[model samples]
Target: MYTSTPFNIADQLPKGLQALMYRAQGAMDNEASGLQRRSFLKVVSASGFALGAFPLLTQAQAQAATPAAAASALKPTQQPSAFVHIAKDGTVTVTINRLDFGQGVQTGLPMILAEELDADWRLVKSQHGNADPAYADPVMGMHLTGGSSAIKNSYTQYRELGARTRAMLVAAAAAQWGVDASSLRTREGVVIGPGGKRLGYGELAEAAMLQPVPEKVTLKDPKQFRIIGKPTGRLDARAKSSGGQSYGIDTRLPGMLTAVVAHPPVFAGKVKSLDDAAARAVPGVKAVLRVPLDRGGEGVAVVAEGYWAAKQGRDALKVDWDTSTVEKVDSAQQLASYRALAQTSGALKYNADVSPLATAPKKISAEFVFPYLAHAPMEPLNCTVQLSGQGADTKAELWLGTQMPGLDTLAASQVLGVAPQNLKMNVQMAGGGFGRRGIPSSDYVVEACAVAKAARTAGLTAAVRTLWSREDDIKGGYYRPMHVHRAEIGLDAQGKILAWDHVIVGQSIIAGSPFEPFMVKDGVDATMVEGMKEPYDIPMRLSVHHPKLNVPVLWWRSVGSTHTAYVMETLIDEVARSAGQDPVAYRLQRFGDKHPRHRAALQLAVSKSGYGKRTLAAGRAWGVAVHESFNTVVAYVVEASVKGTTPVLHAVTAGVHCNLAINPTSIEAQIQGAALMGLSMCLPGAAITLKEGVVEQSNFGDYQVPRITDMPTVAVFIAPSADAPTGLGEPGLPPLAPAFANAIAKLTGQAPRELPFKLA
Candidate 1:
């Protein structure tokens, strides 16, 4: 049970003890670390604490002599037990363990606690929780937040926490009044007893905390939830609307210098020689230092008084790089080779193939290829670091908008030669992560720390923050692997799918990467598992994952589903047409009532999109597709009209259903945004090539995203569910490409097998 005494660093304690506490709390703004300068305010707002509770819990947990005692003491601190502390004066403080980027987790998360805690929701405060293994998500198993797992993972725990706290508060009031606990119930912000006697939660916080923590917490049924189902105003809405919201880029320190690393054009290349004299001569260029790459990465750094100065100085510095190997690797030819590789047979089998690739009455085969894509988060990649002086004891602090805070802490500690405990990592609001934030084996943070250490002079290492320009970030390493999929399906006499064989050839996103230790299994990456398996019951279905060895691949927005869904959904349409059946009706026959959510999505989209109805507008047709990811199921129906030279999608109807909605408004925004993002990838976001490698496109200008003019009018609907919450962010994305492509096929009278879904 959480005790509600306001935390006070006792003044009578030793000065050193106070300093350590203050440092750990991250409240010492006078001599802030690199992390403080780059992300202090941002982290404070995004996570809602000076620092997270992990360190405080770590300090307390370490005092236990036995593991059992430590476990007992922790007790997982059920949501009601930890969320929303009430003070004597009535200040309601809410604790949020979920990480927030621009996704509004900071706002949505606290709303759940406020709803059940029954505190003055208007005055509730918020804070971020620290990383702890015990607090690790039951599904993902780490004190981290991504994959749209925030609400889904915390939904039940937090609601239970709120209800339990309400129970505790009611019990406390009942005890004071000498009445039965069951006779008292909560309404609004006060506890009301049988005789109408009442007391605010603030008046009973200390006593409530002393109550025994309940082992079994009962959450309120959905029927009684007040704040969850309805759309309430956002918690951070006022702050954001008033422009008081601080993003990572707005973080700054007193003596902080802006730093920018000059990354090698080619992967794994190094600087043979560099002249920084001209850079040193440039105004505002405080210090010009070259830091060696950590591990087997590529780069050097340039520090200056400001961002523009650092970028200018970096551009002026002469660098001769070793790009001998990758310079000759042509992206166009390499992609073609990967396509060829898809046809070959060496691949790790995931699902056994009973398919008729070994001779059948009718066999249809098609090859589909996908292009590389950038995460292109609204906020580009950036980090701030401050390294202390020499020796293994040298401490480094980092402030990065990364998804995996624990991983950042470990990597930064290793690079700085300090124990992980001594290192501080502050996670700021990522402009966006989309799986790009938790990339393994990438030294983006380590390089910044190394540069800070190398810049040390006179017992003072450099306080540097690195910023990757939009251009640099888009062209940067770590991208979604372009893949080639070879699909062969055999149909019986009635055109029912009997044998299905799918071979996927792509760079392993985890193989040989830092995540290899965790994500890889027997050389088969499960990232290829999503759309690779036949959701429908196919008697003979075989899925093979052929890992394209060279090049680095990271999980994109939809990860494997981005590629696999395109193949499966489009092929399903082909088979439906071959059988002379309606696409929606045919798919429905394959699915049963067992998957209520999946069926709901199909039915909702079919009805809303007028699936079998005629299009009044000439030259326009509608097409539909459905896919499931991160436990959430989505179906998309697109209405497209051929514009003579290009296919222009005019409207779309989408249906999604996750278990519970912490914030209906935010979930809607995420679904709507994800749909547009997926649409752009299918049409304008294409990677072209030159004589050597990728060329022309860099940022939004060359590689266009969806514009206001091109955006389709979308109608989104949510299906209700009674199970555990599923992810909402990415599931809405995987179906857009196929939905749009299928529409194009109907209009053009040709099934388009590749992207950039153009008729020409």
Candidate 2:
């Protein structure tokens, strides 16, 4: 069902002002309708004012009886808008509002819309939506693609859009046939009517544009769905597999020069002096100019004919950095400080008296350390910017795979001294983002725009494409914040949680971000404390310390769940073992009846993996963990064996409860990918470190990711549900490490408390 954001008038506003505000809001809703009406009128008027012979359904009946409108109570704040485009050749192009960074939203969203549209699957295609106000997320009111919200937020919206478009087409066809619109039906790309009459949607496109948009339209029921819930192949699989897909890194404009910047070794360090003579002497080098970097630092960008030339010029450049302004962050020192801070309560998140901890039957005090982690998307960061015009008429265009295109456009506009509307962003497909592409500062995009503006000022008059080498991309800041967690737990003989006191010390990701005002409250960053004590409902007291450090930090894939899930799940497993009970049963007991999804998912994994019914090999053991992130629950039952001093995962069975899987194949792929990433976090040398304010690792050689050999056999199972879909991208990640670690703990009799486990 269509759901629109309700307009509420403040008591302070005058009646006249409130009325004006309502009118403005209504205009926004009707914007798409107006466009559709104009197109339809033009077609009908041009066709000698020919009218359809069928009677249209009354607006009231259409609004009340439609399954699509009644299914969802929360509708789009604005009208169903700019996504579907039908070509005369019957090719239907659907524009996705979010970045397609391997999470399968590129195909999943279209499946939702196309299912309701009843369009021919073979004729359907998809494209990335540009940074336009019309494409803003209906709920977020901005361009964003993180937190695995792409499908969850836009599921109903896209479905309504398809239903509306189909209704309009039916109206057009009914008019032409002089039949009742209610008697019309659509199957595949054809409209069917009495006497088996049929017409392709392409033929009715022009006339359909003239029909008034139905405020409500019927949506297909789950039993009737032909697209969603099916194992459909990705729309872009062929292009990507065939090496024909162009990511942000592949963007190239005529006369576009490649740029590589030599940044300060220290975070926010400035260049005291520069020597560019040798750099300029390099052939193909166009210009070398100092530019402002993210975090108020300074860098020199070298523009050249190509990437190789830019790198050569950048490598040839020399600069003396002034590091006096910024604090030199040493990883070891920071860990020491964090450990000390974790001993004391800083800002209270959950305040429950834990005085009973001393008297509990069983007690455990644990300290866990999570090091900084780089996002390290497969494709390195890059942006292409072109500037035109001058002064007030100046226009700027950008090409990049941006997670927050609107934010990037705003940031680029500020950097180039242009209006946001004048700056155009052409969204491109991304190889993979995890969370790197959604930086709050739009660092890489702004840097590219700065280089373009500087090049234009220097009479270069070419589009500048700023690219980051592998080393630069890895060493560049904005890694996940390092954290130290200390927990003191008291448990009863039955393995039930009695009292728990926890303290976390880490850098705040949202402190200086535009989202801080809303995301951070009462001196607590919500992202920092999510997944602390949940599902089991045994929270005692939790406190956090947000230490402002020179090392830049941002949200990783699952944000706080990355660490919290490990802590919670592992600790719960430990408690179960200590109580002489099965871990899965213990979890189920604690879950009681409130967490049916969690119980169902864990039960599915257990039943499928034969956790209690099957015997393990001589050297192997079972591990199980369940977590909910992004409103989705994922449970993993893993088999692992310890070889020498290292732990090796052999197989994994996953039970996912994301509700109504849009594409079962995509969900399976995402789970497998996330599981591997989780395993990557446990491998040695996976940490991102800082020594005296300089990033230690530079590339894959030092900062390791999982290779194909490291992957285990993963089997995914989805719980049965017809409820609204939840996010699948990140939920699969949080449970993997904890489950793997639990198995290792069983083998070694010691629980791992740090990432990149050190069995030695």
Candidate 3:
């Protein structure tokens, strides 16, 4: 039997990728042995690689990136040298610290940097960075891209990086021509001397690196921005459009072997016995070995020459699984348990008086059920692990679209018994991750490493790639936790909320991970209640139950907002209807002066969609929802018409107030994609149900998602502002389904409470 539970995914899902990176080498509870959080960050900021007044990357450093010199990030007063690399041919390649898994940071981040660098827009390109410290998030001090933090957190950092690169080029040209650097200027990748002499960045690049990175540089003013606010195309747009783009799934190494694991039907179920006689007889079969799985599970990995062979070999295997010790979670039974818990007191998050609920003139009680959801990224889950040498002196290289390379490196190092410095992670572009690739456990990476280790132990010297098929991934654990929300509201005669007693029952996304100490407080996991109450300003007595079920839950697209926004917005619209007020007007009334962003976004969507000024078609009705997540506000105004049992979405207009739109096209793309994903929640077969601890849906046939046929005509309008840009990758998704739900309610006099629409 598998070992008893210790630290699992709830601990790893984290509060959107914030974890203790310095203490990753030891046990989950090892907090005191490593550098304290604040102290470690201070050290990194103070003494971390300072590229100021030095070559961006020395010849030796350029050839190899070791852990001792891993951090190349500059301080506030220093200049960034690692992110931007100028080629000899004048092509500028910007290394993005975050994974560009369809979020469009592939171009947005570089736009910000290239704008300040005064580089030729046509020559700009982007690539993903490795596990080096230079690529870590400035705020979190980890190599993370979740929480829509990529552009938001790196905005100013990239701006300064570009500016400093420009300054360094100027200095290089100045020194070459023996002129005062102050007398020189740069424009469109060229350094202009006093006599109008121009030096292309390409000609000055080598010299520029030899010169020092400018200690202080001037960032471009918003009005002077040529690239930042433009609707620039993604660096990989043409490749993606032409079907030539390479994802992590396309990784190919010389003599690399493919692997497919035969996991137990039940999560964390142990393997009692196995017979690989048929598997071994198959041609191209390498070897099959029993290995430990994530969260204390056991499975057999089949290694072969190719994916088809591995899959075929896996299909031929026979094994008996012991699931007696693990949880056999039944969806129906879990719902029953959640329903019962809704009546009891749980961990108090927000303590507001709910006494008015008993005697208020108006009252509404509602309950919601959201089923477990799989990420189901197009790329599936694949990690290619290559190891050379053995044991302590062994060196490793990994290729994958990993969300948390820092943690992955630590986990891989321990698994292969290699030093952190000896390992190199080649970050690849992912087709889509939503949140699967960024799991706290680095499960996929560890599994791949385990398979590679097992292969080497079996005398197979080639690199091994552990690939999960569509079935394996869909049935894989670490899904969006199913949530049950109960809300009892007390409202005044005018539709103003007087009191809201709310209860959310779901597994904590970050309960046991090393960061639990910092995130979960007083028995409350803040992530579980993110979008519960806000903007509208209402007294909400919020409580949550972090039930310990065997199921592992992680953050999906927008984290908790995936469900919270739906619950909050639909309930808000329902409350508005009960008050005999127009949902839009009622929402505006509630906005007051405290939420001008929300009000403006809503007004923008209304005005843009002609929501109130124009009449809809015969069967059409307007649905509106506005929510703010990750410091960005998105308002959706949609038209819906019901056809029998199906709710037909006609059109959608989005109003986004994210302070700044770095690249209008990228923003539009994110919103368009996110809105479509949001629509998925209402589609049939959208829910992932567990029966007897086994996932009932194994692939897209049983577990459905939003397809092109389901998409509505969508238009995105961004609010104008000079403020630093906020995130767009996730904010657009939270309010979409709720807005659609609100519209469906307008057509039919009922508010939908369950996802995948159980309406008859």
Candidate 4:
């Protein structure tokens, strides 16, 4: 999904060229260290061609500086599109700034640019970008992919890149023909001249490379778009389907050793004693050394020839963990504390006078508890690191599927004792991340760098690949914070909300993060209260209490909306039911004129799903919910049944208003994937709990994700619009659980207050 924010791109060259320059300088430095000078120019010639295609600097100016001096002058203001390459074969390769990670961005972003470039779809291809300053999110000015901001932030930038490249190609054609550039027009990679002369983009590529870059170019009107709103298949879909795609876990480097760490059961716990004799004696075990862990802890890393040997060596290792300095958190105790805290308002966020609640004719009080959830992406976390040289000459290179590659690069540089400029990050395709890969701490990446550094200190010269088993990933500390919500609502005879008082208790996801100062304000984490009383007009008091627990918590798929939407939507349904009004009508009436997108999405789902017109079968009911997150609105009309006390979702029809759809096929897939994940949260054993400060669930056997049998039939529909695209990855998720819960509540005459529903 794309973000809807604009960014600046006028001050520099692309990072690919800068990286080439750096490599050139490194080659010179390696020669000084008694190493034979490698052919750096040949190594970067392909990327140099792409960069040179965009005239950031004239030939004279570029020739004036030595390669090393030019490298030093390359800064962080570079634009990403400078690397867009038009190959001699007519293949237009556009490098994406964000990780694809199964989100279809590899194709969706290129679709935007190719649409404007008027390139033939068959000749278009895309590649993953590295952790370079040029790849930073335009609005955030950082390398990040969370909040579904990829497409929204880069839509215009990429379009302009295409427009500018087209303008240059036209200019080049005009110079060759001795005519005004306006006499030439492009269509499907061909420059059509006034006299009917035609030239393929491939024939004009070299000349286009020499033409001056235009400062501005007119973007095509939405009405003229031949690709932006079209449904296009993903470019990597065939590769992934044919099992030819490589993810982070599939990364392999020559002379690379695999490592697995034995972390303390309790977070931030230190090793009291160690016995690595058995580990070291294990066959293929090259080294066993203690390394610093994330969140201020220490762990033992067993480096071996392969993953199996590393796991075997890790299993053989024994160490006494010291937990005296860390707080022991038990899930049962924490829930009790959260429950008690939710009973009273802690810090006031929205202080509406809910004094009318006591005098209202109708009142409802509800308390909802949501447990911690692990990201549990299909591919477990893994990072491969290779270090060269030492001191200031030390250069580090990392290969991983990172959501924030630039941040990870900086973090890895610190861990490897190298300057950030000396580090290179190769972003790989990720199986799935949700929000786990975008952590502010860069925990997994830092840990991998630590293991590589430890191996280097242990006299090992090979690259180190740090891998986490499925068990290790589940037991990993970062999780969605457990939350408890208390709500008191007063409604009139017509189900109009008079006053609503709500209190939420959870650990702050951004409290200790570098984003804390900006994301947290006035004793409240903005994410903690995002979806409360939204998309509908209401007077309410919302407060929050963030407890400092030992459990490490991070944002899940939709952040706070994962829990908030369920609370608000389900409760609103209950209020409508109590007043004897139809849920959809009640919601529509309350939507009021301010939220047309919300009303449109809801109406579309209802009309298309036949929610009000078609009668459900016996024991099944209609479930409806709408929510806006990441600036996109999604509404779900679902059919659900309580099958012998277990809720079974039969089918779902989604109406999404992301403004403009780049690739409707990709949007549909994202919604289906997100919906399934949302349903996973309601399944039994979905919670991540702690006992004596240790994660109780280790793998799929204990921690449950949705199985094939649990998948519901889903249909997706997009609301028509020419507005810029917002986020699609997360908005599809927030409404799913609430819609399901609303149907179950209708069937059982009970409003479930906690996750992993226990109707039996």
Candidate 5:
């Protein structure tokens, strides 16, 4: 195994208004293309950002654009009672409605608020909010941090929150001076009255609380924006970079016991027998208890004074795991099964005619495979649970970094036998989640609560923290599903798509979850076929098979685009080559005028990259790819070369169009980290393979992650827009692998059919 320090980009780095339809409010960000087939919303392919802009901001921005309106009704959840807090020291703290697992919403959302509040940037700070109804997304009506909707969905809400606070502060200042509120103006935390009278927001904060909260207030226009578009540094950047930051794993409670679970080797396997004689002999060992696991299984947890003692105690225990009931998944055999299924007609997703395929001038039949991937966030999954009292009077507190705090709270409360209202969730700073910590089952959280409950039942009164080692996190269940995409592509004489017949085989991510009714329709998982067609208009028959597998899978970053973008882009490049045309030009021609955002993004990357103007070294070639995910578009123009069997990415230039650039520096960091992660897909040993129902790889020793040296020189440039920002987190990742594959294809004269590049 190679040796290296953990390359954690999380420590290092970094929407418009339109429809009010329920589908728009609760819709997935990447469904701009899926609108046509979706029964709820009519598809408007010609208009990209207009149709999918954050829907709640339409009337809010219009009415709130003015300084003050006749007081309108404010939903209890919309009031700023819990969000904006001012200290006597003039420190303005903004509470973010979502978790900050390195996406910089901890800073970005505050920028939106502080901008509208006209607060001094130097004095503004941010903190993560709890699972209160006040923090829930107004549109989705949930405590969610995914789909890049934090700023997009909350822009108007935060603006109004800031404006209302400003209004109340002005009203307080005006009443003190016996002047109308309109006569006073706010500038950098100060209310300026007639004759240069001024007061800091700190002095008026308490008095401002007594004033009526305004429902509508003015928002600065794009031209008047001083902080919104400015490339300000992240509030947490210094703490993160300086190693002074605290994550959930760093929590230390009084008399808290540390826990390490000895999970069954096979998923859903049960512990046949567990002997804790040696485990109990360990000096710091407190207790050894068998607890119920997620998926109706059982595991033994070792509770000790600390993590090291707990782990040692766990290692000393003897456990017998029963694998008889669970399915033994073999990667080789599974691939064979998937390939076999791809040959037949599966459930129909799109029923476009295939008659043109038989009569087309040329045809290309290709099959691509993608393997399961672990999230592997820098901090392994963990949760600290403190239980007090019992039964109906039970009160519990949990500390963790969670994407879906509300769901996790519900799950933990149920496991701990505490009422949901009695459970207090402290949203902690997370190293990174990338979608692992947001499981619908709330697996880790539930397991922690279960361990605490078992400990309490066993007479241990202290709180318990369930900690997963790096090995456990890597081998843990929720992984990106393995996928096989088989396609028959037909091209006319002009190289336009005559027909595309496609079949995908993979496990459904949302099948058994509470979201199954909404996310899975007509037996087709919506996440499986997201990135296919449009952005380019192509007629095709799309089919899918969601084989139920024993392994649990969740939405990894960018979800379906992790595989779909690779298939579509590589195949598109191949078709472009066959047609003797430039890949970028071909994609541009396909984009036409229907998608101006895509066109602008591609053009920006092309011009900034000097694609045709600069001459590359003989060994290196320019590679290009563009994709839209989470409603954000990212285009890459890369310079790449091959060294032996490995692909070497030399330089990358990204053209990002998420409408508005809230923080260009943060956007750059996200792209760099995501691209490096994408490069990991092409490295040897990247796949999370399984054999005999046991994970073949455990930790970084066996798995391959990109090292710092492997990172290319990435340059990011944004295409500016006045429209609201869209998702920026996952879009950067999807196009990176396909662009690298396209580059390697140019060097080898043959495209890679699988990830981790099996080149000869």
Candidate 6:
């Protein structure tokens, strides 16, 4: 009952592009070693010619009796959560269950399964799975990937799938040898019998398909893991390192043109009218496509043959924009609006009444504000799409680096008027994502599809459209909202915290977007309270969220905690000052009584940093901040001195996350990376405000990130955590601003709350 079906998809590809997939090899002489059943070979030798190959799936065709492809015509544009393939040669491949924006999980996650399956690590590969409902996030509605849930969400399911595959192979081997299944056991790339009979994983792969899926298969005990705990280099590192990797900018299809877009000078503005005659006359210009804002939000864009040409054409064209809505949208206005709103009783409320303040009459009330922020990832947004007409291959192919591929696919499909399956999205390595790339709406994808559709009429097939010059991305509309917190804390004379009331006012980031269902509720946005409420064992506390007067906001690197943690930790420092207590001691006392993990991190940071010790420079002081985010706890001690009134940081000592999929080394690298990113935001990185609207700081030059010169000597200590691997990428970022602010406050008798601290 064994059958092998072979069909060629090469004909569907361009002339020189053969199928990218191939079969792995099995042991030739050793029939019983079971080694053939476990190993997915990287290279196979046949007819004296050695071929190096990797797992490449070219969409398998269903067998005669299996579910017909048409019957299973899943709306590919919808979104998929999980889509994996197991080749008959023991090769295993998984679509990216989540997005990768340089967090290294695109390589780390597949390693999790290979570790469990005991598959040859080198041979395992992955692909970008299109969005579908089946791939929907268990927690979120659709197959969306954000909120540090990539590994956490897929932990058990990926292992189960791998284990199930292994069990089938074992069963197939048992049937082949006419032996009881109990006699066989799987090891690294092999299955062994009681009498020493063994078979390779590849040899049993085809036969394994005939076996029924095991009702249940035992997962490996953590102690028995071979590859899961071992540190493996990134699977895509070589390709990226050698400059062989193809990013969205490298996407090329037959006759595909290039495109650039001209958006409004301000956010939420409408294009009144534009003349594209001059743009259309450009040498490479094909069509001056007018992209309208009516479909989704605001602004109009122009399409051209090449990005530079599009830019040239855009500059040459004349247009008038209705900036009525944008005129009232300034940072100061937003801040004041949020401040007033924070005083109101919002639809969603927590820690509402300040009755707790009565218990301790000497309460502290402070207002903290964090300005709007931009996710200036290195690679700007780019998408390449190729769309054919209805009944004329109605499919569109997309190549881009997006944290929200599922959403991108769905949006692209909607614009193209095709099913999701008709759209193929190649998820590329993001130069950086940092919450910005997880845009729920596929605005960029839609724009690319629109450009491609227009180009198709002129015989253009492969068109790539890129958005964002450093100016464009920095001034981009989706922003980390300017947030204001009106926080009041009541403390007894002895500094024993009694009550806490925190009210955060900011734009409703999720109110009307695709993420609204999970993010917005009762006028409360969860992101607004992420780090606003302490996990401390406070006697009485209330956290509240107040929506702004209809302004736009989005998630930053640390999401809500990007600002909330700063407010919470800085306010705690103020409380310590009022009580005449050491800042570290106060946090330790409070956290020790409430959260052991938080206390553990805080103590480790203090102890390792030599807290209370004098630095080489006189008038220099140190301040500490501890925050928990993305399930990882982190603490920082920033040592600084006041140059005039501005604080110049000299060194940073941090005791942060230890739970990791890889090891302490990788964890430290991520922590360091996040620390630098955090510093930039707190220093010269926040978006500036002007009379017109948000002004462009423009790239890393004007909107400076922490460079080697700006960076301090950082010491990272990993508090050993046996807990499940928590996120180390973002948690380190939340504490940097607060620690720096607290340090400056100690050096000078001023509690600096406003970000980008300037003493003048």
Q: In candidate 2, where is summed lDDT lowest over 10 consecutive residues?
A: 1-10
| lDDT over C-alpha atoms for residue 446 of model 2 | 82
lDDT of 4 at 191: 93
Q: Candidate 2 versus the native: TM-score?
A: 0.91
Regions more than 4 Å wrong, model 4: 1-49, 52-81
What's the residue-level lDDT of 474 in candidate 6?
A: 73
lDDT of candidate 1 vs native?
Answer: 0.67
Worst 10-residue stretch by lDDT in candidate 1?
Answer: 1-10
TM-score of 5: 0.91
lDDT of 3 by residue, 1-760 (tens): 0000011122243454444454442332232223243443332234222221111232223223233323444442123545766766788888888998999998998898899999999988888877755677776667787888889888988988888778778878888999998898888888888778998988877666545555467777688988888887788989999999998889888999999999889989989989999999889999998988998999999999999999999999999999999989999999999999988779998899989899889999999999999999989999999989865679889999988888898889889898776777889999899989998788888889999999899999998989999999999989999989999999989898889999999999888765677668899887888877887689999999989999988989888888899999999999999989999999988888888889888898898899889989999999999999888999999999899889888899999998988888888888889999999988889999999999999988899887778899999888888899887778888998899999999888987899978779
Q: Name the candidate, 1 or 6, with the larger TM-score value.
A: 1
lDDT, candidates in the order shown: 0.67, 0.83, 0.82, 0.83, 0.82, 0.64
How much does candidate 3 score in TM-score? 0.92
In model 5, how large is the Cα lDDT of residue 663?
72
The clash numbers for all candidates, in the given order, read 4, 12, 2, 6, 3, 31
Write candidate 4's Cα lDDT for 111-224 as tens digits.
998988899989998887776555667666667788888898888878877886788789888999999998789999999998799988877775665555555579998999
lDDT per residue for candidate 6 within 325-394, as digits (tens), equals 5554666666777788777655544644557687785788788777777777888877877666567458
The whole-model C-alpha lDDT of candidate 2 against the native structure comes to 0.83
TM-score of each: 0.87, 0.91, 0.92, 0.92, 0.91, 0.84
Question: Compared with the true structure, what per-residue lDDT tens digits does model 2 show for residues 1-760?
Answer: 1000000001132344324323433433343323343444454345321222011111121232335533434333323335666766667777788999999999999998899889999999988876655465665666678787888888988898889879878988999999999999999989999999998888887667556667767778789998888888999999989999999999878988999999999989999999999999999999998999999999999999999999999999989999999999999999999999999998888998898898999999999999999999989999999888978989888899999886787688789998665666888999888889988799998888888888888889888999999899999989989999999999989887889999999999889876666667799988888888888778579999999989888888888889999999999999999999999989999889999999989999998898989999999999999999888999999999999998899999998898888899899999989999999899999999888889999999999998888899999989989999988888889899999999998999977999988898
